[model samples]
Each structure stands twice: as C-alpha cells, then as structure tokens.
Target: VFELGDSVNQIDTKNESKNKSAIELLKVPKTVKNLKDIKKRKALANLEINSLAKLKALYLSLAENC
Candidate 1:
C-alpha cells in the first residue's frame, strides 16, 4: 500500500524543477548608453540561446560559423 503523504511530497518535488523559462524585457535603445545591451543580445543570439538556429541540410543547425 502507498502512503498519500509520500505521494504529495513527491508531487511537490516534481514541481520544483531547476529548469524554468524566464523572459527578460529590455528597454528600447534610444541612445548610445544601450550599445552594450545590444551587443549582449547579439552575443546570446549567436550562441543560439535567445534565437533559433539556421537550417542546414533540412535540419536546424546550432554549429557556429567559422
């Protein structure tokens, strides 16, 4: 026989996962002060974290271009 309390604890633990989706809102770049932020976004996109990878041979490729 399984204990109800034990099942409840397991369900709570399952909800507490390390991987969580987080979206950050960045201010519009209206001046030179936002140049660094722009560069950071580009870097992340290049790493394929905030953007989709290009398609190659009919499949999405994450390989960086030399």
Candidate 2:
C-alpha cells in the first residue's frame, strides 16, 4: 500500500510540472503579440509626428510668401 501511494504521488508531481510548463508556453505567444502591437503603435505615432512637422513647415513657408 505504501509503495502504491508513493507511485501515485510521483505521477501527480509530474503532471503538475507538465501543467505549469504548458501554462508558461501559452503565455509566451501572448506576450510576444503584445510586444508586436506596442511596436506597431509606436511606429504609427512616429509617422504622425513627422507628418505634422512637415505640414507645419509648409504652412510657415506659404505664409512667408503671402
């Protein structure tokens, strides 16, 4: 009976470890996707800023000519 109990405990421990590893594996892709989304947003924001700066310059040049 004692040996049987020990064998069950070992199996439970292994199963727990496998479950934890699977959870971690699932989280990795979500983290990577979130990072990619953040990078894409940052790039869009930079483009908007650059475009506004160019428009401001053009407006100033046109006003000077007027």
What would the per-residue lDDT of candidate 1 be over residues 1-66, giving only the tens digit for each residue?
Answer: 123333433433332321121122244544677767756764654444322212221121222432
**Per-residue lDDT of candidate 2, residues 29-66 (tens digit):** 45765767656655654555455455555555766898
Candidate 2 local Cα displacement, residue 54, angstroms: 0.3
| Candidate 2 Cα misplacement greater than 4 A, ranges | 1-30
Q: Name the top TM-score candidate.
A: 2
| N/CA/C clash count, model 1 | 0
lDDT on C-alpha atoms for all candidate structures: 0.35, 0.51
- Please provide TM-scores, in order, for all candidate models, with all chains considered together: 0.29, 0.52
